[model samples]
Target: MYTHTKKPTGLCIELLESQGGLISLEDFHELWSMLRKTHSLDHLYPLPTDTEEFHLLYIIISRDQEHGDLGIHANGYGIEDEGKYRLAGFACLVVPPNERREKSILSGNPNGICDTADIRIALLPAVQKRGFGRFVVHELLGHAFDTLRIRRVTASVVSPVRPSHSAAQKKQIGFNTKQICRIFETFGFKFEGISRGAVMNTEAPEDDKPVWHDVHRMSMLVTDYFEEHIISSLSTIRSPCHKLPLKTVRLSPWDTMIQRQEEEKRDLKLWAEAPKDTLANDACDEDGENSDVETMLGDDDVDEHDWDMANDFDD
Candidate 1:
């Protein structure tokens, strides 16, 4: 639903003209093609559309102009000539407004991307370690704060130590441990806990062979708080052997007792119904015998008189 109505190109918001830079849909297509050619993922799904990803490229270019993302991504980043751009880097920028997770608690930041201007850049694989990834992110965050008139930004990426991944193993593509850490440090993104229910893999798949694992989710934010404490806070574990937190819910004894009592009562009632039902059926048989005795009185005809005479004679 996003249109290519406005876009910015080049570096420095101050250097931008009164109307700012504009990119045509054609330009976006060119960028998209370049990204595909660079990454060799022209066949991947859940990635941006050929025509669609350019819209995101538009946002990245616009924000990058003002150094918005740059303030956040600092490490392993080098500026292109005149701060224009670092070559040999690519990512499909996306808004994915509806696809974000539980960011409702983050009221100060909107849309879960951190700031209204906050832009998320998915780094292109071909240009990852060379530092263009950090540079692009830094520019995006800086522009979001300055030109876009926003406070901060947020971003996330998959963890390297994921449980399983058929695609990653199949594609021979997994996260870069050092690079991922570098990107977060550069962008002021913080480490939140791993989502417990997050699926790292699927045993069965629709189109392909059974997947053995899935990707892990990690979150980030662009803030002074994260910037000041990111390094120190990151060192909280100090070693890579940090233990995972887990909780177990125990069943209440009252519930167990109530369930046991109900079952016992039900069984007892079923057993108790047998004798009462048989005794009632026997009484019905005795009533039939009494009816037969009345039939024998047909010859006597005077039932009450006969009963009185018979009783007096018997005495």
Candidate 2:
């Protein structure tokens, strides 16, 4: 079961898993389908359709009561045909493994034990300047820190360091990117690093070297966000709807893929070094010494039990 919280603006936040419940599963599909086509303010990046590989990908949809106008879609200025309950905007929370090697570039901890997550938010262009984006993000943080008890939250912002091709493109880049970084900064996230060519430009050819753009990573520790609550010795501050049972989802396939990749890399390393060691060792060397080589070459001794222990967390 998921939880529901009413925001000060009369918008209700429904915390849902991949399989949604507060809204019909069909509605959730419609939201994601729309999001896939929507671009950022600069029309630079769009949500990728293939998201099955990511674990702990949860959708946070902000909804408001139906009004005189159904309102405009976030992607375009055209009015939506949908009913009273307008889907104001949506955000995504991605939880990667604490020890993921690829993510170490962002977290700076190879064997980090703290629970951490990344956030990506998108609000309709019509609703862009109304503080809806900030609200959506706060809800996500509340869930991460209060419910999931995550220690750190990180977000990526497109940096203006990349060269723009046209005058129009330059203007779009300056406006949208700054707004993105500013929003996160307002929530106490600190500037971490600049990742060169980390973001891909959808308009450019995939093979083009410059298709990638620089991105600034920002992070907010839980201690910084909830400092006031702790200082007051309050049991729990009612920032996001209080004390809701957060849904837990276990994505086994993603975890399996990580384990498989780790094993493949380890095996390759062992085999690549085997040839060099065999040539240097004396033929008269003890059989026990040669046993180590045999163990590396023998696939039968590969431990399957160890792989089973690498389980993905339920978010």
Q: Pick the candidate with the highest TM-score.
A: 2
Q: Residue 236 in model 2: shift from native, Å?
A: 16
Clash pairs for candidate 2: 66-84, 74-124
Per-residue accuracy of model 2 over 161-235 as CA lDDT, tens digit each: 345357787777756676667667666677676687777765556445556677777898888777634433343
**In model 1, which runs have C-alpha deviations exceeding 4 angstroms?**
1-23, 37-118, 122-130, 149-152, 158-172, 175-178, 193-222, 225-315
Model 2 vs. true fold: TM: 0.51
Cα deviation of 269, candidate 1, in Å = 54
Q: What tens-digit string does per-residue lDDT give for candidate 1 at 1-315? A: 011113224321111111233433444345546555554332122343343222234223312334222212211223343444422223433333332323643554443442432233443443334444445555555445544444444444433233354676534443343245344644445444334423333224535644332332333433553353444344444455565333223333334568899999999999988564454345334545444444655544565665554455564
Any idea what lDDT model 1 has?
0.39
Residue 7 error, candidate 2, Å: 1.3
- Per-candidate TM-score against the hidden true structure: 0.36, 0.51
Following a full C-alpha superposition, what root-mean-square deviation does model 2 have from the true structure?
A: 22.7
lDDT of 2 at 191: 69
List per-prediction Cα lDDT, in the order shown.
0.39, 0.57
Candidate 2 positional error at 190, Å: 0.6
